[model samples]
Target: MEYRITDGIVEAIIESHGAELKSFKLLKNNEEFMWKADPKFWGRTSPVLFPIVGGLKDGKYIYHGITYEMGQHGIARDNEFKVISHEKNKIVFLFESNEETLKDYPFGFKLYMGYSIENSCLSIEYRVENISHEEMYFSIGAHPAFSTPTSENIEFSDYYLEFEKNETASRFPLEGKNISRNTIKFLENSKKIELEEDTFKDDALIFKNLNSKKISLKCKKNTRVVTMDYSEFEYIAFWNKVGAEFVCLEPWNGIADFVDASGRLEEKDGIIKLEGQEKYKAILKIEIQS
Candidate 1:
């Protein structure tokens, strides 16, 4: 099932499967800000990454003297969620840990994805509740793809990203699917990243502890802008398929396992631990200005 929400100026569509965001658009101009899920490039618009952010070492993890096998980015995005609430401008979807989920992730939990639209902004709220008796270790993140070249005359290189504040941070390079121990100089008190076709030749750029919580996607040829604010997240990344017409801005609460991982779930980097009955919430907002 799919739900729609609007606040006069902007509109959005949410799908029950994975509680994924399907569309975001402006009402008057009929302009779309989200990727169209083109199978030729990438088939997903916005996918929710949960239980884990990236790939595990050898695609398995050891938890409490037991080895569990799970794929990259965990199991939330490929499943169905129940629609718990629906309103004109707000909608909520729910996912719970079940018998199948326990086989891969040995924890009981409830995950809710709340989407709300207000004027020109859309907020994606992720709420997690640990229902288990013991401690639970997990991670969550967002993968939202934004369409590029809003006008036919512009090319991908004409687009650029500007941070709300200049950052002096280094990004961790990825060695295959796991995180490498090496650090590459990425930003040096700079605010803008000029986008090009070959920018992602080595895959996505993942950064940690960035000074800016908000980033804007802008094009030199167009006055329109798309900004993302992920204040509570510790990590932010930029990604895209080579030569594709879209870009992804990701905000993550946890990270992937290091290359020399200990194989223990609790020992993973940036792992979030929650006590029984505890709740965790993360908000990611996308604003569009014409």
Candidate 2:
């Protein structure tokens, strides 16, 4: 792991595998931002194609004429990436498919990720290039866990997503290999409950029709807040491990299973496709304050 710092921002490139974020900078109004990525703080991961939030059938997805092996969230997460460029307040990392990937994913592809800091905003950009003659399909997202204190004396229910508007959102549910059209509405209509063990009680909040580019998190004391924005994503997912203290607000170019489809990658809902030999791109931005 190595880091590059400039203009109050620190960008880390993990040369060991997939050149993940390693650590993201948190800049304040009058000071330089800090990067706390010692595994105990924050480590970055790029969840590819199917950011599988749960178990999938045999770690495989059936495509055109055969079945393909894909890890829980695809291969990008675990690959060693190279730092291609670094300058100013931004850094670019690149990851490409190899012999091992070809065995599972037959397409030739290139993924270039960039992290840029401008003032108080941190923007993440992902560019996917199709190198083969066939169309390429995949989903990409960021999984960055912000720090929280357990001794804060605030219950999980003390926090709620504060949308700019009172308009509520809806989401379909998923049951181990099955999709249920049963929907979960947001805001009070979805039932506000405490964060408990084994509770995703309402399933991941799925909002596909977003009129705004940002979403914010508000705590009971109104002390902590984090906002994320994405212009290219059509879906936003909010999730966490049953008892984990961290909440992941994910902006996705594609989504997981819809209530009525087989667990197939190419067939999964919200898939990103690149025309043969073309390129696809998307961005996610986060701003945190306390």
Candidate 3:
């Protein structure tokens, strides 16, 4: 099922399955700021990554000497979530660990995803509660694709991502499903990344060390812009299928396994170990100007 929240100025559509965001738009002009999920290009608009942000080494991880197999981004995105609340301008969806999840994750937990809008800024929250008696290790992240060039007169190349602060970050290029230890100089004391089809030719640009906590999608042809403040996230990435008209701003608390990584879960990169009954939260705020 799907639910909607509106603050008169804007509205968002969320669904129970995966707790994924289906749409976000301005009510006045009925203008959509999110990418339309087109199967030809990509089938997801906005999907939350949980338990793990990326892929595992050798398609599995070792936990306490036991091996478990998990695919990319974990199982939360494909699981069904329960609607916890749906008030005007605010909504929360809940996904608790189930018997099926334990087969791959081997832990008991609850994930809460909340979305709210006040004026033009949208607040997104991800909360994870460790229900297992033992210390639980996990990771979480966000993947939201926004439409670029909001007008027909402009092309995708006319848009760029402007960071809040100048950055000297290199991208860890993907080696198949895992991260390659090798790095490529992407931004060196620069703040803007020109959006083009070649930007994603080697897959998503993943950055672990960044000086900026926020970025804005802008174009030279118009005033329409989408800004995202991902202060709580440690790693950030930008990705899109080649030839697609949208771009994804991914904020991740953890990254995929490195090429020579140990298969242990606790040793995984950016793994979060939560004490029993403890809760962890990550938030991202988005402001849209159109």
Candidate 4:
């Protein structure tokens, strides 16, 4: 099922499958700011990553002496979510652990994804609760893809991502989808990165420590801009398919396994641990201007 909400200035469409945001558009000009999910490039607009983010070392992990098999980004994106609440400009979806999930995750939990629109900004919030008797370990992240250029006259290369503050962060390149130990200087005292076709040749640019929590996408010839604020997130990622017309700004509270992982979920890098009856929350705000 799909739900829609509009706040005079912006309208959004969210589906129940992943409780994912399928579309975000400006009401004044009827211009879409979200990706169209082109299968030729990418087929998702915004997907919720839970229990895990990115790929495991070998598509497997160990928990409490038992080996579990899980694919990249976990199963949240493919699972169904229940609509818990809906308002004129806000909606909330809930996903609870079941028998099938226990086979791979072995934990009882509830994930709530909420979307709200106010004026020109859209807010995406996630709340995870541990329902199991024992402590639960997991990861959660956001993958929201926005259309590049925003205007047909502007080329993708003319666009760039501007950070709120100057940063000198290192990029951890991926090794066949798995996290690698090698690090390279990505942003050296620069606040913006010009978009290029080869930017994602080696997969997503994962940054562990960044000085900025907000980033804006801008084009040289276009006045349209999109800003993403993820103050509560611990890590950030940028990615796009080669020659694709969209880019993803990801805010992650947890990351994937290392190339040389210990195979234990508890020991995985950037994993979140929650005791019984505990909850965790994160927020991502996206603002569009033209």
Runs with alpha carbons beyond 4 Å of true place in candidate 4: 150-152
Give TM-scores for every candidate, taking all chains together and pairing residue i with residue i. Answer: 0.98, 0.80, 0.97, 0.98
TM-score of 4: 0.98
- Candidate 2 ranges with C-alpha deviation above 4 Å: 4-6, 9-16, 25-58, 177-179, 188-203, 262-265
Candidate 4 per-residue lDDT, tens place, 1-290, comes to 99999898899999999989998988899989888899998999899999899999889999989999999899999999999999999999999999999999999999999999986789998999999779999999999999984355667889899999999989888888688888888888999999988988888999976889899988888788999998999899999988888999999988878788998999999999999999998889999988
The worst-scoring run of ten residues by lDDT in candidate 2 lies at: 29-38
> Which candidate comes out best when scored by lDDT?
1
- Sort by TM-score, top down from the best: 1, 4, 3, 2
**What are the Cα lDDT values of the candidates?**
0.92, 0.62, 0.89, 0.91
**Tens-place lDDT digits, model 2, residues 244-283:** 4655666776655555557566777767777799988888
**Which 10-residue window of candidate 1 scores lowest in summed lDDT?**
146-155
Q: What is the lDDT of candidate 3?
A: 0.89
Which candidate model has the greater lDDT, 1 or 2?
1
Candidate 2 residue-wise lDDT at 278: 95
Residue 202 CA displacement from its true place in model 4, Å: 1.0
Task: Count clashes in each candidate, considering only residues at least 3 apart in sequence or on different chains.
Answer: 0, 8, 0, 0
All models, RMSD in angstroms:
1.0, 4.0, 1.2, 1.1
| Candidate 1 residue pairs in backbone clash | none
Lowest lDDT 10-residue stretch of candidate 4: 148-157
TM-score of 2: 0.80
Whose TM-score is higher: candidate 1's or candidate 2's? 1
Model 1 residue 37 CA deviation (Å) reads: 0.7
Poorly placed runs, candidate 1 (over 4 Å) = 150-152
